[model samples]
Target chain A: MAFKAGVITFPGSNCDRDMAVALEAVSGEKAIRIWHGDADLPDGLDFIALPGGFSYGDYLRSGAMAANSPIMRAVVAAADRGVPVLGVCNGFQVLTESGLLPGALMRNAGQTFVCRTVPLSVENASSLFTQSFAQGETVRVPVAHHDGNYFADEATLDTLEGEGRVAFRYAEPVNGSRRDIAGILSENGRVLGMMPHPERAIAPAAHPSLGGEDGKRLFESVIGSLVSA
Target chain B: MKVRILVRLKPGVLDPQGRAVHHSLEGMGFDGVDDVRIGRMIEMDVADDTTDEALNTMCEKLLANMVIEDFAIEKLDNEKAPA
Candidate 1:
């Protein structure tokens, strides 16, 4: 069976094409492009991808406006139905804003935009998203965002940690996120949200300035999980 | 009714922008600035019949992200506040 993935494109989404390309490269299937305005997603989607970008011009708050867009209602419903979803950067913000995930992405503690490849540890290898990586293995991926600092109350943070919902942790402090969290998975492990753009790092030659193909495994993991399921 | 919603980062949450501004103030020879925190104020015009429940729902749903921020809602009477 061919993998069916859909990539959502909000008005200010700049990385939709890259996400589509990455999906195609990994799954060998063309990604369906969905606009933010449409109220419904295509029937029977195996996976959904929300790419990083300054949706709605980062108005009100990063990803806040886009989270309330018409299409998000469908996205939220689809996620609840166990469709795997991946949110990157701004898309991660949307997941938090939409209540699909916990915690919020605040402005970087450095108070400046951070754009560089950083080392991340695979904290949980049990989830569909991180199964490709061995537990505690470190990988380098690029992160580019101003509001990528993850914040949650101490109790919630503790709960997430105890439940092993933390999917990735920064090997080094790239942003002042609580507990150095770089990525997280939903309770069911069907949804994954992270600030780093794995799609941008999938191709080894894609970013020679920041060399690595560590991101390819992320896409492959999702594809493999769907195929096996 | 004119409703004002003040959304602020919860206490104990790090406020980098606020800290940066505080540093700038200290650089300008200001003293006794114990700390600084930044928040947002959103004012809205709603019908007089708008119930407190509705306002609270709005805050919980959109005006504030409960994870990192807290919100306070204030309603001004028509006589003194702008519609």
Candidate 2:
């Protein structure tokens, strides 16, 4: 059977199509499109993706409104069942807002919207989402967001670091994320939330300065891990 | 009843927006201002019979994110309505 992947779309979600395209390109299967208002997800989904975008106009707070949407209840339930879930950029904000991931993405310490390709250090490559990355290796991914600064209490930070939950870290400071942390995996390591837009980097760009196949490798990693298991 | 919720970032959390506003104030030559921290105020008219639990629930569940922010609720006597 083909790999079953579902990419969720929330209102104002601009990257939903891109995410679906990336998933399909790597999985060799049509990606399912799920809406935020739907109370239930389609059954037998092998993977779930929350694409990046300013859902709800980023009102009240980034990802605050979208987290409370009906579909999120189902997403949370699905995640609890060990489904591999990946959230990128605004999707990372949504995951933190929904309590599926720890810490909150705040306004960039520079107080400006940053859009560019930045290098990230693969902190934990053994997880479901990052199996393709080698630990301590650097991969360039495009990040575009205003509220990408990640914050967590000191104790929680210790716990996350101790548990090897930090999946990715900014190789250089692009935002004000503490410890330059760019992405993290859930306690069970099935869910990943990151500020970089991997979907945007799936294709090798014409220029080396631009992103490359790192994103495709991420999706391929998920597919490879699941198919082999 | 008229309700107001003030959501502010916790003291220790970094407030980039607030810091920017403070920088702007400094640029404007406002020497009297010691510090500035921006917050949000949300006003709503709920039923007179609304309970405190319900109000807090709304803040905790949706209005304010407990992870990085704190919220305070105030109920006005209606005559002092917000202009």
Candidate 3:
């Protein structure tokens, strides 16, 4: 069968179309658009993506409200079953809020919303999302948010690093994430939550600042891994 | 019954928003302030017979993120909505 991918759109999510378009561009298949209120995901889905945006106007906290919505329960179950899940920006907040990932994204230590392409290193190139990347290679991706500073206790950070679960790390300081972490993977490396927007960088642009196609490799990696599996 | 839940960033977690406000206070010439931390207060009205477990569940499940936050539940003695 054609690659089965789903992109979920929480209310106020602006990156849903970009995510779907990127998925289709890389996978040669239309990504199923799933709504936040829907309780069930389409079955046999090989991949699921939660795109970035200010869901519920970022009420309570970034991704706090949407994490409790009905659709997330289904998403959680899917992740538990070993389906690869990718969350970006606010979606990263949602993943942490939903308990699918650890730690919390707090307000930026710079006390401002940072929006630009920043360099990130592939901390773990073996995960489903980063397999296309060479270990420790620098990649540029766009990040736009006020609450991307990642925070967790020291012990959890040690555990994540020791297990090689950190999928990406800031090559240069962008947000004040602990240990300069940019993205992380679940225990089994089936789930990834990152503050950077790979979907925004998949297509090459006239301006180098607009990002090249490094982000496409991530989706390509996901598609390639799933197809072979 | 009326309940109040106070959610705070757990100790040692950075609070940039609170720090910004502290800077503003300093800029305004307020002195001797050692630090500033911010917390959220959520008030709810529920059935009189609501159980403690249910209230705690609400906080644990949605009201607060346990990773970097802690919450305390307070039951109001009487009607204490704003005057």
Every candidate's CA RMSD: 1.6, 0.9, 1.1
Q: Give the per-residue lDDT of model 3 (tens digit) for A1-229.
A: 5899999998999999999999999989999999999999998999999999999999899999999999999999999999999999989999999999999998889988999999999999998898999998999998999999999889999999999999999898887999999999999899999999999888888986896898899999999999988
lDDT of 3 by residue, B1-83 (tens): 77889999998888888898999999999999999999999999889999999999999988898888899999887856533
Q: Model 2 segments beyond 4 Å from truth?
A: none
Q: Report the poorest 10 consecutive residues by lDDT, candidate 1 chain B.
A: B74-83
DockQ score of candidate 3?
Answer: 0.88
In candidate 1, which residue ranges exceed 4 Å CA deviation?
A: A206-208
Q: What's the distance in Å from true for residue A150, model 2?
A: 0.2
Model 2 chain B scores worst on lDDT over the 10 consecutive residues at B74-83
Candidate 1: deviation at residue A50, Å?
1.0
Residue pairs with backbone atoms closer than 3 Å in model 2 (clashes): none
**Candidate 1: what lDDT?**
0.93
Task: List, in the given order, the native-contact fraction of each candidate.
Answer: 0.82, 0.88, 0.94
Candidates ranked by TM-score: 2, 3, 1
Docking class of 1: high
Return the candidate ranking by lDDT, descending.
1, 3, 2
